[model samples]
Target: MEPSNKINFSRRSFLKTSALASGGMLIGFNLFNACKQDVKMPVDLSTLNYNDFNAFIKISPEGKVTIFAPNPEIGQGVKTSMPMLIAEELDVLWDDVYVVQAPLDTENYTRQLAGGSQSLRLAWEPLRQTGATAKQMLVNAAAAKWGVNASECKAKQGVITNANGETLGYGDVVLEAAQLEVPENVTLKKPEDFTIIGQGTANVDIDEIITGKPLFGLDYKEEGMLYASVLRPPAFGQVLDTFDASEAKAMPGVVDVITIGDKAKAYLESEKPNWTAQLSKSKKVVVLAKTTWDAFKGKKAIRATWKEESALESTEFHNEKLNEILEGSKFNTRRKDGDVKKAFAQADKVLERTYEAPFLPHNTLEPMNFFADVNDEKVRLVGPVQTPEDAAKTVAALLGRNIEDITVEMTRMGGGFGRRLYGDFVYEAAEISDKIKKPIKMVSSREDDMTTGVYRPSTKYKIAASIKNGKVTGYHLKEACINGNMYGLIPNFFPAAAIENYQVDTANYKSNITTGAWRAPYTNFLASAEQSFFDELAEELGVDRVQLHMDLLENVKNNPDPKIEYSPDRLQGVLKLVVEKANWGKTAEGTYQGLAVYYCHNTHVAEVADIEMNNGVPTVKKVTCAVDCGIVVNPLGALNQIKGGVLDGIGHAMYSDFVFDNGVPQSNNFNSYQLIRMGQTPKVDVHFVKNNIAPTGLGEPTLPPVGGAVANAIYKATGQRLTKQPYMNNLQAKKVVG
Candidate 1:
């Protein structure tokens, strides 16, 4: 695992840190930026007055302020919204504040990741305190200059004004403020007095993104960086048998063909349970060349043979197994309140139905790619990694290098629904660079990203409900899914404790078609199945759909369980808001409505889809969504996430599915996969509940409810109960009679 090349200390140090002491107000969590501690700061440490700010704030003498956003920005708007939180409490003008994506520095910023919609939730308190501390420091500086009490000075929009009307801008005081001691305690602004948080501020990166600036990982480049294309096993559960790269080596611009064996086992075994690394394991041959096109051409020129394992199973096999398990498997009880069998026997009526969701690919707009420069001394990795710390761990372990020697820098990702969470691509680039003794940039083509990537496992849900005295008194859910060992966090789902007699059970079937996190994970399938069944139960009882949901929520509210994770009040809050906004009871001309609600990631979201059949095809005309994610960080960003999640869910429900045959994915690209197009997207109306609660994540909570909403709406439009995914497939199988 040792690198062949030796490194020089002076040159390596320059690449590690940023330019820290260029004569300005430099504030950061870490002391080392562009040089080692042996090199003293350009300014005197005493004159520079450094207080203990957690991380990420720098003010130039000329009034330019930069705040480094700690988390990765995978189209979640953290880069813009997080900085707004800092600038808002600091009382700085929006125009003067600039944002930068912070490099991976675990010592300074903890949990610097983008997943589970938790970036804002975890950083809210510390970031607010950081900004408030800076503001207090500036005020203290001004008070010392004027020889007045700090309380007498009022600060707003980067300026402090005294009782006598003497004003000093933050820029003017920053140099002197840098010399003042940071306050031990500072009060944050009340919600009623906020200016930047609730307001609809546009994303700061919009101009750069629109103008085609080099921000994404695919756009990254460096001097002497060689391009690489990895050739993966043709199918899942297959291994590399042999490869003849002699033809590829002779090609123009081709440098080397290196094979990366399974280096993930050691890293995964060291951890308790690392499903991300487990799913990301792959056996591949990397073709290195001068350019991406050359690498691609070289990969095409090479011929590799793969050996298919006998245990490999296909999608059809999995579907059959799921059916078998659902029909006869003894389900392990995850959550149970009452005897399901006894409750069903005593009920006036019983309704049972099965729902299925196929395996799905992330299909990120930018395929997996990473750049790595490694030697015996240091390992430098730069790419679109959602989990930087995890990626660094894998790289360090694989290369047998010190963790400190590894530096992971994140670039803006084109899209990572949840795909980039696995640092497999980062490791692959590092491994290739180490073996080849050169800097490498590994890229996965659209085909490689789609076919070889970890997919959202196929799932089956068998739900039964019992109606006694005109009310659903009992509920049972039996889930059988694939890749249960990998991403089985939530065993029991919402409404489990809502009913008087509720029983939840699950059974997992193992599969080799790697599955990891996909948006809201299991809720993506569970919400559709649970809500659809609830909708059917409502119909059987002759109750309005929305009213039925409200009644169940009320049941939970009246007889609350101590173990209930979601608040019935919050659930009802969003359901009522969505119904009111979507005109639930009224049907528009040529349109039918459907309702769905679910809670996940400590956020409650309800959505209603308005649909109309266009030439035998169900078309979503409009959608109304109501969210209760506590406080809104940026209204514009939250709304965008809500709208995007709805559209993404609708697209997946209506069209997306990945089918495998003989251990190979049948759908290779967009042509066969069928993604929801922009023209087919429905008009969406978003609303958020006003509350004093701290902010939660909005990126994923809005997606889970969408499938159920659309399915329920389709049932209203066509009177056909579609139980399988890609609802269009079921709709197409039968023509609606005129």
Candidate 2:
């Protein structure tokens, strides 16, 4: 069932209601005196009393239920799906619900970040209980009006029906309901009885997004707001030395040029260092102008020189360091089981392979931007930030102001993909506003975003397996990455418990390059490496690849470990389902297929890639994916995420490449960088496992296994092992010579 996207009120009506609500004279009701005899309810629908049911909900006199979505919507459809959980349990019609993005309210919402894909998983129970409690309160109010037991009256679709068949709208009893003591416990609906959840619902902000309305950070503006273009060090390991901004200040529409970072540098050097200092650049040249284009133009006219603080590193340097770390004896043992030495000694064959991937930028469609209005009185920050609370706290600390004096408003993001998780752009906006003591909108060009962005750490993995008498015996996996390793995050994932003689080691070489989470984080590349290695191991063992995975899963299921991070039953469920749906071994002429299954972000996913040769090049034609994320919420949004992750994974593994030459990024724009074009995207068929379990995560789980599936398929098509990422580069180098 598809929920309607049509809104009941017109745009003008919404604006009027918003204007009136902002004035505090309308849509406001005293919770304590809601049932007072002297209190009067307004008649106008625009001015109707909207009693706050809880932090997440507000009910109006007209029965219009407004559900507040606390998490920032980074195109993951949380704005639509999270509210569905509330509406489903509240016994309210989906059409009668209006969703709003809630401000940062620490008193009510916790974990208000958009990264880690834990938004829904963490809020699942609490949000449902919140709705159920409100519904029970309304039922109790209706029962009091009828002089009957609360159990005799039931609420459904905003209406309460008594045993005598008499009905009353929820609005009729909302005042009295507000006066009743909050219920401690309320019954939640069974998954089987859900009418709103498990159904596809259109995005709540789809209209605003498609109509070119102000939704994203780039579209935000305020009165007397100046546009800011900030110039920082052009390369890593470099700091600001000197700059001449006279030419920039003379540019048309240019307002002024200001230097920042002195205060930040001082704060960082103090005895008590602030964590926000690491988020923003320590030195910058800001050009303020009346328009965005003018600001950018003025920034280009500035002449700046940088001083290197350390040796400038390159891709070659990173590769050498990673390889050196992998070969070294000193390493951190993440996980170890039985004696790997004994298992290897008894093995008949020992096979090893090394896989490598380069650093990658998040490349969110919207370049980093934010709006800040900071002053001694209060600070108002508005932008697309995944962590609004963190951003607010950071700004407050930098400005030496009370956190309560700051307010953060979240705007819909064009894309996050873990990029917006860092509020550097937000910090820049706030610092510029505070320095100039004026409101300003900080903007970053595509080049600035690409060159100076938090990137996915480049990593190399060396995996080895021992086979004794045609059976897998021992496994040793070593990971070497930039800045950090995956030792802490996923030590208990698959393959850890499957092999008795399993051991995992990790090492890192801290570079000047900044790195952080990208989409699924470590599992993004680790899954591809592990899955591909398993495929090669299957070949050496003379067994089917699918059977090999099933066998490993059986081992994990039989000998369950207390620290196991994923469910064996759930992983097997997706693998079996995908095998059936993709016709595991069946393929048409000239079509080759490969399969991969992985668990991450508290979800299990299996994907099969179908590859066909197109003019001497193998191209992905279609992908069949099976997911078990527990109960599916908003199948439309779920399908979108599945397809998007698959395509994104394939694109990056096949074509995306980011390189640094002496600490300076070589690709500053799309001309040098490559992304999967429309012609390169494959057809993705998604199937979800039917279950009543609560939802887990959908934003990033489907991405981790896609690269492995594509690589395995390419091996079948071309008889070549693609070990390095940006597979197209390797494929081109190995092209048949005429």
**lDDT for each residue of candidate 1 in 159-231, tens digit (9 for 90 to 100):** 8999999999887887778776556557788777788888899888899889999999999999999999988
> Which residue pairs in candidate 2 collide?
none
lDDT (Cα, 0-100) at 299 in candidate 1: 96
Give candidate 2's error at residue 531 in angstroms: 0.4
Residue-level lDDT of model 2, residues 1-738, one tens digit each, is: 222222132211111111122221122211111112233334343553223111336677678787666678999988998888878888899999999876665433346779777877766665565567668778998999999999999889999999999998887877777667655456677777789988999999999988999899999998899999999888898888899999998889999999888766655566765332345334899999999999999999999999988878999999999999999987889889998889989999999999999999999999999999988898989989888878887777777889878888889999999888777888889989999999999999999999988889899999999999899889999888998742333778888799889998888999878887888988999999999999899999999898898899899988989998988888889999999999888877788888889999999999999998878898999999999988887899999988999999999999999889999999999998998999999999998888877788889999989999999988888788889998998774344221
Residues forming the 10-long window of minimal summed lDDT in candidate 1: 1-10
Each candidate: what lDDT? Answer: 0.79, 0.82
Instruction: List ranges where model 2 is wrong by over 4 Å.
Output: 1-54, 267-282, 485-489, 732-738
Q: How many residue pairs clash in each candidate?
A: 2, 0
TM-score of each: 0.92, 0.92
RMSD of each: 7.4, 6.4
